[model samples]
Every structure is written in structure tokens, then in C-alpha cells.
Target: MRNRLKSNEGQNRRKKRTSDVEPVFGHIKSNRNFKRFTHKGIKKAELEFGLHALAHNLRKKVS
Candidate 1:
């Protein structure tokens, strides 16, 4: 892991990856109260998650 972090390509990838995802998760956990999914199966779960994300974005837009 240390060696991987040392390379230029790896460093850039790491920076890009870290910037990409953390905030959405933090908001979902803290603001949305999204702890677990209620639906079962792939389609239902995907729909539920999409709705949650849409709600989160709408809240962001409104506030």
C-alpha cells in the first residue's frame, strides 16, 4: 500500500477517488437518516436507493 501510494499515477488516482465519494455518503448518513434499505431484491433496492439519492439532491437544491 505504501509503494502504491508513492507512484504518480497511484497518487493521482487516490486523489481522484477520495474526492469523488465521501461527501455524498456523509450527507446520506447525517442528513438523510439513511441507515438501511427497507426493500428486498435487486430491482426494489435499486429503486429505493435512487429515490433516496433523488431526495437528497432535491434537498440540496432547495436549501
Candidate 2:
């Protein structure tokens, strides 16, 4: 048996990502560009979500 955060386990988890999200909410509120989705339907929303995630990743890579 093993404990959590032991032997660098927790450190590994901390090294992983998070936060392709926090700024989006702020952007939506502060910038009208992201506020309100004119797009409709679950399928369309899902596609947009995927695209946003992909774009976020690409941006992170470039930066």
C-alpha cells in the first residue's frame, strides 16, 4: 500500500495542467466578444467546445 503525495506522486499531479478555464469566464464578462453564444444546439456547442480547447492548447504551445 502507498500514501498520497508521497515519493513525488503529488508533485507529478501538480506538474500537470489546469486553467484553460478561469480566464474564459473573465473574458466572457470583461470582453463582449466572448459574451453570449449566438450558436445553438448541443452538437454545435460540443464542436465549439472542442475547437476552443484545441485553440487553447495551440496558444499555450506557442507561448
Candidate 3:
């Protein structure tokens, strides 16, 4: 929808990868804001991703 990210092309053309990132992303989607992070910048994006990863790892270890 946004001009910055092409929808049909991005969703279909991007190469899918197997990694822990997918499961972590699934858990993070419990929050609506996370479904589409509005931040603008590599540092901010990295921080948000790192926080999600940290939460996921902690939950996995405790459970």
C-alpha cells in the first residue's frame, strides 16, 4: 500500500528464508503495532527486532 514498499511484488518476489526469525515474528504479531512497525531508520528497526528476539528467546528458555 505504501509507496516505499511495493505490495504484490514484495510479497511474491522476495525470496523466503528459513530461520528463527519467522517464529519470533509470529509471536510478536500478538501486538497490532508490531504487525507493521512504523519506525523509520535502520537503528530503530534493529532495536525493535532485537527486543522481539530477546523476548522470544527468553520465553523459549523458560518454557
Candidate 4:
């Protein structure tokens, strides 16, 4: 894993990955205050997260 991260391709991928994903999670956790799922079952949790993702995308689109 360390060796992979040290390579050029891996470094580019890591940069792309963080840019693509980290901010959405940071916004969701910090701004939205979504710490944990309120639903219990796996399916319900997935549904709840799906809603959150949808809301995030919609907000991004609006802005």
C-alpha cells in the first residue's frame, strides 16, 4: 500500500480520489451534522444514506 501510494500513478489516483470524495463527506459531516444513520437495518441505512447523497447532489446543482 505504501509502495503503491509512492508511485506516480498512485499519487494521481489519490489526488483524484480525495478531490472527488473527501469534500462531500466533510460537508455531510460538518455542515449537515450527519454523524450516524437513524435507521436500524442495512437496507434502511442504505436508503437513508441515499437520501443524503441525493440532497447533497441537489444542493450542489443549485449552487
List candidate 4 segments past 4 Å from native: 1-6
lDDT of 2 by residue, 1-63 (tens): 256655586656645523545676565446535555557998887787667667666766999
Better of 1 and 3 by lDDT: 1
**Candidate 1 error regions (>4 Å):** 1-10
Tens-digit per-residue lDDT, 1-63, candidate 1: 898889998999988877977788788878778898898999998999899889988888999
Residue-level lDDT of model 4, residues 1-63, one tens digit each, is 999999999999999989999999899989999999998999999999999999999998999
The numbered model that scores best in lDDT is: 4
Using TM-score as the yardstick, the better of models 2 and 3 is 3
**Ten-residue segment with the worst summed lDDT in candidate 2?**
13-22
How do all models score by TM-score? Answer: 0.69, 0.46, 0.50, 0.78
Lowest lDDT 10-residue stretch of candidate 4: 21-30
* Overall lDDT per candidate, in order of appearance: 0.87, 0.62, 0.66, 0.95
Error of 3 at 41 (Å): 0.7
Compute the lDDT for candidate 1: 0.87
Name the regions of candidate 3 deviating beyond 4 angstroms: 1-21, 30-33
For model 3, how does the per-residue alpha-carbon lDDT over 1-63 read when each residue is reduced to its tens digit?
Answer: 464246765644443432435655666787434676567899998888788778767887999
Best by TM-score: 4
Q: Give the Å shift of residue 51 in candidate 3.
A: 0.2
Ranking by TM-score: 4, 1, 3, 2
